[model samples]
Target: MTFEIAFVLLSLLGMVIALILDKMRPGMVLFSVVVLFLCAGILTPKEMLEGFSNKGMITVAMLFLVSEGVRQSGALGQVIKKLLPEGKTTVFKAQFRMLPSIAFISAFLNNTPVVVIFAPIIKRWAQSVHLPATKFLIPLSYVTILGGICTLIGTSTNLVVHGMILEAGYEGFTMFELGKVGIFIAIAGIIYLFLFSKKLLPDARPDTAVPDEEVEDGEKLHRVEAVLGARFPGINKTLADFNFQRHYGAEVKEIKTRNGQRFVTNLNQIVLREGDTLVVMADDTFIPTWGESSVFMMLANGKDTEPVPGKKKRWFALILLILMIVGATVGELPVTKEMFPNIKLDMFFFVCVTTIIMAWTKIFPARKYTKYISWDILITIACAFAISKAMVNSGVADGVAHYIIGLSHNYGPHVLLAILFVITNLFTELITNNAAAALAFPLALALSQQLGVDPTPFFVVICMAASASFSTPIGYQTNLIVQGIGNYKFMDFVRIGLPLNIITFLISVFLIPLIWPF
Candidate 1:
């Protein structure tokens, strides 16, 4: 290997190690790698920073605002209520009823917020009806992931790949292009969950249902459920360190962690994490006080949350979201493309328009817009583009592609496709999905060129594999959200999600080339 290629490979190995160890935020780790590339002359200054101005990255930022608008409008919360059955139901029946629709809804919104909003409601409903919350929570997280793969704007990873495609001078994916293959995987995966999840998933009994009338010292105490967000000041700190009761005026009664365990006895000593769920005892003001706060992703009282936004505002937010999706879809059609040859009326344009409208109309708090977007993810994506460029620039991607192709050339591209899928999926399970796609994109691009085949199949596999992160809770943020709420163990995810992961893998390998062609 040339010194440049050797440097890029070693740097990438270090990046992966840093990401896996989580020694720093993913964006910073990636940004550090890009800077190193720039210094080594592997990437020009413009090439290193081009991702900051890339259309795909900006679209992701806008979608975060759009998602926040819908989340604030209380529309998703209402939808979850309507989906759950009114009475006691079997695990299969409950999953069958909500999983598909949840997947569909998730296709249009960010998966994390979708899970954040729905998890508490579903958990409470399952307990009320005598079903295990554990049965439905993991499925809820999995379906959102399934749904995210259905659209270009479904997940940040799709937009990241789409950005890379545009930068490479190829026609980027349409809003519904991924849906062609994604729908099948989603349907099949959901069916797999419906069939096996009931047996494979553990059934952890929820804590005793909280009573509405817990009179203590002649004062009424209400049970408030709060799912900690990244912004929570006390993350990685004990309750005593943060003075949870003194600051929030709510006494934490039980703490559930992402490892599928709970700490009720040593609440004061337990260290807090982003996805931990806390059942606290407080007065009526608990929900209203922290309802819109950034510290908690979701806060609910008993089985319900505070009143949603005004009906008119809720309807307007929903309509705006629908219009954005339809507009982006139609813009990508050949007829529309021909009419607007000079101006690309695409997702980026519609999202920009929708975000401004939502801000002006106050769907989400406009002034606090900065808080809605995950800057870390955007940084990670922009840096991802830079890092992918470095790989291509250094010839490392081509060298690795040739090595991989040599191993499987006799077996044909099908084997190559499967191999690429396994690598990307494993990385996603170990790190973040966007980071995985970033690491894999250049190799996939080079492999197609080396084999004299269209890169479309390779591109499609990257999208699918990077998103099929079901084997572990840490792979996807949605899984972590549900882990604590459901009280699921690490092995619980392995048991059920491993099978679903395999199902998605088989579908991607056998089905993608047929649709996009190699």
Candidate 2:
């Protein structure tokens, strides 16, 4: 095998293993692989570095800041609080009441913040109304994801694919262009959840859900999970001996071992191992104190409950978000170029202006702006661009495309689109969605080029497949967020999300060809 081909295969294998094992973050793993390609001379420095300055990747970053500003504004939370049904309700009634509005918000705004703002509120609402919180949590995440697929700025993955299309010298998606198919998928998805979710999803959440532990006086406990690392000093020590509570200001709720059995009954006598996972009850102070500590490498579900923003600030933030969305959507029309050629009235222009305004206005904690942006994701995306370039440079994309084509040679582009959807969806389930999109883009593009068709359809399928990450918690961040709070088992995702995944796959394969064509 050629050195380039060997390197690419090895890099891909390593990524698959890394993402599956989850020993390292997907962004770090992808970046590390790109660095290897750079060292082997498989790719030039410029090619490897293209992702750093990628318009899509940077746009994602700016959106993060914008989302943080919105989150801090507390406007989304208040809106959701108002929209939730009053008094007790049936599962279908609750879903019918909220999913459409949730989807609308998700279609225009970032899904992560929407979930973050809404999940707890929904959970509390469910509890007060004598409903199962679990029924709503997963649905909340899924609806946001469904909504995100509708607009360009709705999800980072959409923006990443949009960025790639522009770089390939094609006309990128306008703000509402994706909504053409996306709206249909969103409608299909919400309808699917509404009709079948009660039967499909689990109605699980502890009837006596533990309250947050007091860090100081009068602070309630919040249940959280922390995975142990080698850096933890009390590896073999019992919690009682280690004084875990005294040291961390948290109480152990349960101890799940590497062997998979949880010891919620007698955790004090159990010896902590490097890989043992601890379910603890902590207060807000725990995050700032031990969140970065090496002792627990993966800490989750310690959400802070801040008071909502004042009416004036909330209105200002809401107005800013509306302006950002309106400006971007309106600018995509023919009138923009003829009337405002001098102005760069694209999503990029509006996002930049909105980000700056939010920053100057201190909508979020200005000093902690860096904390909101997932630098690892940005790094992974930047590195993914290089990885895609490497695949193209090494002829890996064409080779893979040809091999698949040989098997499906008798089949038309629809079959190819199905296979592409399945492949991208698999990659997404194994790795990050952005990483999956980056890897799939080149192959999808090559497949279209070889078939003598427009690459637009392939691009649409890639977007559809990459974001249809419903099979596993690892497939999407939103899944993990809900998994932690909902007390979901691995099978919970498989049972519920698998069908959603299949539904999306079907929708993409059937609609992309009809809409964009081969």
- Residue-level lDDT for 36 in candidate 2: 89
Model 1 TM-score is 0.94
Per-residue lDDT over 1-518 for candidate 2, one digit per residue giving the tens place of the 0 to 100 score? 57788789888888879877766666778988898898889888888888888888888899988887877787887888888889867989989989999999888777776876687777778878988888888888888888888888888888989988988889999998788888888899889889887887787657234565565677677887776754677877898889888888888888766533467787789987655667788877776677545566456663435347798888898899999999998988898878998987899999999999999998977777877787778888888888888888888999999999999999888999999989989999887898899889999999999999999989988888888887776677677666655666677778888988888988878887888867
lDDT of 2: 0.81
* 1-518: candidate 1 lDDT, tens digit per residue: 79999899999999999888666668889999999999999999999889999999999999999998998888898888999999867888888889999999999999988988898888878878988888898889899999999999999999999999988888889898999899999999999888888899887765646565555577788877778876788887899889999889988888888666777787788988766889888888788788777788777675566358778878999999999999999998899999999988999999999999999988888889998888889999999999999999999999999999888879988899999999999999998999999989999999999999999889989999999999888788888877766777889999998888889999999999899888
RMSD of each: 2.3, 4.1
Count of residue pairs whose backbone atoms collide, per candidate? 1, 4
RMSD in Å for model 1: 2.3
